[model samples]
Target: MVTGLTLLHTSPAHVPVFDALRDREHPGAVLRHLVYPELLERARAHGPESVAEDLRGLLGDAGGPVLVTCSTLGAVAEALAPALGAPVLRVDRPMAAEAVRTGPRIAVLATVESTLAPTAELLAEEADGRPVSVRTRLVEGAWELFVAGGTARHLAAVAEAVDAVTDADVIVLAQASMAGAAPLARTRVPVLSSPGPGLAAALRLCGADTTAAPPA
Candidate 1:
């Protein structure tokens, strides 16, 4: 099935990563990418309503399932989902669920401050009153590197930020863009990527066979 790849970052680097991952988990699936690099900055400076308006506009024209990949916009996507005609899913939902399961102590890592609250809220909602603790860490100066097209440096900074998690059962990578940082981090705790599980959830919601999807 065709899927709309909604993003708030302008870089082409995330495209190949998502493509490889989508193909690996669901071969031959069609994808249409839509990116607006300044969307998050707007959300941070302005508010989600402004971003949601654009998201709603995109959803109106999207032909198939829509997967919003920006962690900062996850809450906005979910808020807009019920009103849309097609399936609208946030990339971090599944990962947040998995994090709660591993939690009591979960550390969420993000390069942007706009991402932390929404991510933490999602984890809390998924926690289901069984006692889950969330700690948010911002990888200092990382977002600037991304804006400057220094992806390798941006990812390296995120990996280095993992060192700040003093005690945690698992670490949650708040953005799909941070997935690459997992292996680069020098941490013993399990690091989970949002997009992998998110795509899996989207495929399942669409009634597609996800037999090719790898284990978490």
Candidate 2:
């Protein structure tokens, strides 16, 4: 039986983000975060397939549902899910489904260029025969700020990107790291972030009680 949620992340920065989410929403939920910065670097230097073995190595022992939070590696993880023993999920999928339900026109914003294609494809898949149009925006240079530990500036750039897309019915933050920008964005349309929805999905997949009361 599944005992907790296992989060696979390419950056260590995501640890606190999802940890805080579990604390606030799931309180007692067990969450194990495996962060490997080199995984992303190798994927960027080579290709997504390059990390397939590495991910398979890490996931061989992961308990409960495994959530892959990096958009660049999401597809690879998903492709390996059936053989990985545990339930593996891409973090942005829930958000993508929500975006498709919200409207036909969707805007996918990503700080890194690599994230756009994967996220846009996820949205298209989620459309499930519905007519959906997706627009992608790459917040150029914002990823540099994020890597430099300037989260506030990264979020500012993302928020600006969000405001620039005025024609979309809903804006999707392709990276879980970009979620902070959602609240700061002053856009007319709804902004969707992955972390919350992703965690909820992971909990459900693991058979955890998502509606459980939070710690006081």
Candidate 3:
């Protein structure tokens, strides 16, 4: 039985979101976090393998379920999963699965440039040989705003970007932090976020029931 979770995240700002969900889903289940912005930065600066070695070490040490919370590093998580010797879940995998079901015209929106490629790749992989048209958009200056703690401003920028992508059948928010900002978009099509489904999946992967009542 799974009794703990080890969350791997690129940004510290995302911890609260996952923490709340973990607490709600399974209160007091051992939760450990590995936050390293430099990991993703290294991926961008050098290559995905740049962080694979470090991730392997982390996963080897994680005694419970591990969740990769960064879209940019999700590929590395998948690659190292075979050697992880434990259950590993990607935060965006569920989102990718659902997004591909919507339509072929998928638009992935992100604030960080690094998130785009991996997200689109995940969607394509989820499509499972089906022809899917995936385009990516980076919200101008949204990452800066988010890093500066201007979350509202950052969300507004993301919402605007969503509004601008009218041709897309569905919009996939590439980063977990942007999950909350999706609803702010005035769009006719579905706007998808990873955090909700991802957290649900994580709980399940770790042998916790989504409907299981939390401790009062």
Best by the lDDT measure? 2
Q: Is candidate 2 or candidate 3 better by lDDT?
A: 2
lDDT of residue 49 for candidate 2: 92
Judging by lDDT, tell me the better candidate of 1 and 3: 3
In the range 1-216, model 2's lDDT, one tens digit per residue, is 436888999888999999888878876788998988888888878888999999888877785579999988998898887887678999999999999999999988998787888888898899988999998988999999999999999999999989989788999999999999999988879999999999889898988877659447
lDDT measured at residue 38 in model 2 versus the true structure, 0 to 100: 88
Q: Whole-model Cα lDDT per candidate?
A: 0.79, 0.89, 0.85
lDDT of 3: 0.85
Model 2 whole-model lDDT (C-alpha atoms): 0.89
lDDT value, residue 200 of candidate 2: 89
The per-prediction tally of clashing pairs is 0, 0, 0
lDDT by residue for model 3 (1-216), tens: 447778998899888987787667656556688898899889878877788889999888887678889888888887887776788889999999998899999999998888888898899899999999999988889989988999999999989888889788889999998987878988888999998888788878777666547348
Q: What local lDDT does model 2 show for residue 40?
A: 81
Steric clash count of candidate 1: 0
Where model 1 places Cα greater than 4 Å from the true spot, the runs are: 1-11, 213-216
Of 2 and 3, the candidate ahead on TM-score is 2
- RMSD of candidate 3 to true structure, Å: 2.1
Two-way TM-score contest, 1 vs 3, winner: 3
Better of 1 and 2 by lDDT: 2
